[model samples]
Target: MAKTNYQELVFDITRLIPPGRVCSYGAIADYLALGSARMVGWALRNSFIHDGIPAHRVVNSKGELSGRAHFNPPSLMQQLLEAEGVKVENDRVVNFKEVFWHPEELGW
Candidate 1:
């Protein structure tokens, strides 16, 4: 598959994360098993053109919105996550383990 297709694969899976939930780039990468977590972040960073991605739902392994800078105004990432009832304090999701959703273990 081409690079774009790979990105689409990443997006396709990202779209599946239910509301009030979050997933790490590493989990998505592990589930897809085609790219690394950094690649997932890269794909999401360039995903601005697409709608419904909920890119905000993706964060670093430590539950930090490391990709926040890619969002317009940057704070938008944390805002979106807050809107979903996923609390983010200090740019890190609060109680990350509970809110975390693993695509692999979830049968994605």
Candidate 2:
């Protein structure tokens, strides 16, 4: 079988995330056996154009704004996430436990 690139892996993980829920960089990286959480972030950063990565739906382990700077208009990510019914406060998700979407949790 052929190997999948980082961006494609990132997109696959992103697509798995359902609406109204979110995953973290660490979770996706750990699930894919990637190098590190930062590598996930880098994948998302560049996924903007090439892949329609739902980058906005990814947060930090504690549901923090880890990939904020990668958004097109700076705050667009937060706005998009908020529009999805995810509460945002101080650039972080208000209730992480409620919105956290880990692959194992969903049997994915």
Candidate 3:
């Protein structure tokens, strides 16, 4: 696939994460068969400034906001997630499993 196509695919998958839920970069990459969480992170970093992508909902495998630094102020990601009712502490999502969204399990 073309580079933009890949990024757009990542964005599309990211949008599937509902409010108050989160997914991991590895999860999105796995869902698209990309085999690289770093690729997903790159896409998010490049496209985050755009509207509707909700890159904040994507975290690391450990439920930590590993991409937090990409956001302005480096705390917007946590704030956004928290605003949506997902508790965050020490840069990690509290009760991550309960609020985690898996693309494969989603019938989308």
Candidate 4:
């Protein structure tokens, strides 16, 4: 077996997300048909810094922010997402249905 180039996978996932909307780690994994949320998390953590991936926009399937520690000052992701007009409360996005990015709509 070969190690996947998850860095590339992360960017590809990020590109699938449109501005003002977001996706979950599981969604990204499933979109790539990878079948593992942990793999998505690992990929995002490793690639976020240098790749300029919109890491902040990815949350857990329940819309809970789970990558706080990875952010500088530990709250940057929430702040950035909020700045983009995506509401965050208790470290989770409110009404994600209104802001969910569908890959099919974007032709991903």
CA lDDT of each candidate?
Answer: 0.89, 0.84, 0.91, 0.79
Report the number of clashing residue pairs per model. Answer: 0, 0, 0, 0
Q: Which parts of model 2 are misplaced by more than 4 Å?
A: 1-3, 106-108
Candidate 1 per-residue lDDT over residues 15-86, each given as its tens digit: 989899999999999888887999999988878999889889999999999998998899999999898899
**For residues 1-108, what per-residue lDDT tens digits would candidate 2 score against the true structure?**
134787678778888898889999999889888768888888788877865568899999988987888787879989999889999999899999999998777575
Model 4 residue 77 distance off true place after TM-score fit, in angstroms: 0.6
Model 3 global lDDT (CA atoms, 0 to 1): 0.91
Give each model a TM-score. Answer: 0.92, 0.90, 0.92, 0.87
- Tens digits of per-residue lDDT for model 4, 33-105: 7658888888788765575678888888888889888888778988889888999999889988889875556
Question: What is the alpha-carbon RMSD of candidate 2 to the true structure?
Answer: 1.8
lDDT of 1 at 19: 91
Q: What order do candidates take by TM-score, descending?
A: 1, 3, 2, 4
- Candidate 4 achieves a global lDDT of 0.79
- Number of the candidate with higher TM-score, 3 or 4: 3
State the lDDT at 103 in candidate 4: 56
Q: Over the full model, what C-alpha lDDT does candidate 2 score relative to the true structure?
A: 0.84
